[model samples]
Target: MVNDIAIIAIVGGLTGVTTVLFGFGGGFVVVPFVYQLFLRQPVVANHALHIAVATSAAVMIFNAGWATYNPQRRRNLSANILFPLTLFIGLGAVMGSLLAGQLSEAVIRLLFIFYMLVTIIDCLVSRHFLKGSEARPLSALTTTVGGTAIGTVAALLGVGGSVMTVPLLRKHGFSMKDCISHANPLSLPVALCATITYTINGWGKIPVSGFLGYISLTTLAILIVTGGVGISISQRYLPKIADGWHARLYVLLLIAVLVAMFI
Candidate 1:
């Protein structure tokens, strides 16, 4: 247990770095780690994905909140681009969480993998993301429609929604920095909605200790502190990264997490 906690603490720090540098809000880092860890415990093996997703959602709430305060990140946010989109994402998150609670762990994991693969392919194929200039005003249809989709998938997979939002923003000519920064703000809705939904939906579903519905409270406590530490440390150097490299690394990190899920 001691070693496991230490390992989780380390992962928490990494989550913070990713949250600050990539606006992942700890979802990408925490999900695979928690999922695999829980799978190793005989008592929780069957419930691993549920716990993993729920706990990731719980962790993301704070991670996103902490990341949002970064001065550099805050400057990139656009009220017009964020408003109605955020409202719709929250609605979609509710739908996604309910659906997730009913699915088999294997099915959910596969869906997460598929989502990652599609995002990776789209980013690689889209030339606009890499050479983005001034961000244009977003269209109403894209905001309402796209936001809902991002929230649904993100909540279902227990991710921070940055994977979808960052790419969407980048495609619209937002800089990698702007996309990542805005991703933190956008993820807050997904994280908040998913947490409440997962807790209520998962309650009593798994008769396990140290759990609240699907969430692992112990892990959440550890991650809160360690994730905060990570966000603080990573913020110092976020400005040093170039836009192209930042975008490339974001995709690479997703590929790595996708591979990690298999392992």
Candidate 2:
């Protein structure tokens, strides 16, 4: 029991920083660690991946909320700019979560790997094309479409949409900080919608020790508190980072995550 608390708190704290800086909710990092934990319990092994994804989504909700609040307050980002994408991202998250519950684990794993590869390449390609282009606001239709795609992929992969959304936004000419700012709010709806779907879909299917429909309520509570503290600390350091470095780091991290996932 004590060990579980320690693990959740540590992961939650790391995720808080990543969620604020990259809007990833650290799922790429969290899922693997949680999967190993679930593996230790034979009874839950059958459904471990699902629980890991769901739990990650649940944890992201609180962290994403903190991530969004502080930045919007400091940056004074317009809610009007974020609303359309947010709405569509939420809708897509619901649909995505439903689809995820229906798919086999093997398929999901393959899809996750494919997405990482595609995202890395996409980020690299965009660096070339977007280098000198003038920054422009994404249109409402574009935002909605992008949000839907992001939410669906995020739910399937158990990540906050920022992993995908931020690069796309950067490609479209937004600053990394601005992209992270917008991506943070987008995560709220994605996490809420996906977490709900996981809870409902896994109601009786998940048999893990702390299961509350794939969300371990105990872990959720720990993450909320520790993750919030982490977010607060990271926000102060955000401005010191450059956009180019962030993009590069994201690609490296994704490659490392993919290797870890396979191993």
Candidate 3:
């Protein structure tokens, strides 16, 4: 347990950086860390993904909430991009959480990997995510369909929805700062809805003393504190990242997380 806490502290710190800089809300990184951690405990290894995903969802609430309140991020937020879309994201998160609870750990992991692969390919093959597009309106379809799909997949995989939202915004011609800003706020609904559903559905399931359903409260607490420190340190560099570098780094980070998942 001491070892777990130590590792979780490191994970927490990294998540904070990811949250403020990438709008990851800690999911992409945390899920893999927690999942690997649980996999080593024979007693809970079978349900490792659930615990990892649930814990990641819970952590996102704090990380995203904190980042959203950041003065710098607040300045870049676009109301037109976040309004109706966030509502649909919340609705879809509920549905995804329920569905994730029904699947086996192996199945869920595979789906997460698949999601990463597809998104990575899209980002790499497309020029839009790197170079901003022409000016475009926030379309209704993107708000409804796109937002729902992002919420569903993000919740199902415990990825905080930024993996999808950031790229979508970028493709629509938003600056990296604006896209990341929107991503942080957009992650709030997915995190809140997914955490609620996962917590409720996982009651009495994970047989660990530190667990709250599928969440490891002990790990969550440690990570939260360390993650806060990370966010504080990283947030200062938010404006330093150029638009092109930020987008490229986002894809690179995705690939890194995807590789970690496979390992």
TM-scores across all candidates? 0.96, 0.90, 0.97
lDDT for every model?
A: 0.87, 0.77, 0.89
Candidate 3 per-residue lDDT, tens place, 1-263, comes to 78888899999999999898889888999999899998999989988999999999999999999999988789887778889999999988888988888889889999999999999999998888887777577798998998889889999999999999988888888888888888988999889988888888888877768788888898899889999999998977546788888889999999999999998
Tens digit of lDDT per residue, candidate 1, span 1-263?
89889989999999988888888988888999999888999988999988888999989889898888767677778898789889988888988988887899999999989988998899888998766666787788888888899999999999979999999989888888778778888999899888998889878877777889889999999998999998887776545788888888988998999999888
Q: Ranking under TM-score, best-scoring first?
A: 3, 1, 2
101: Cα error in model 1, Å: 1.5
| The best candidate in terms of lDDT | 3
Could you tell me which 10 consecutive residues in candidate 1 have the lowest summed lDDT? 232-241
Clashing pairs in 3: none
Candidate 2 TM-score over all chains jointly: 0.90
For model 1, give the RMSD to the true fold: 1.3
Tens-digit lDDT string for candidate 2 (1-263): 68977987888888877777677765776787777777677888877788788888988787777776773544746576677877888888888998998987678778877888888788777753235245777787777788888888898778878787777677777776677777777777888887889898889886545677888777678878888888888876656666677667767777887886777
Better of 2 and 3 by TM-score: 3
How much is 175 displaced in model 3, in angstroms? 0.7
Against the true structure, candidate 2 has what lDDT? 0.77
Alpha-carbon deviation at 229 in model 2, angstroms: 2.3
Clashing pairs in 1: none
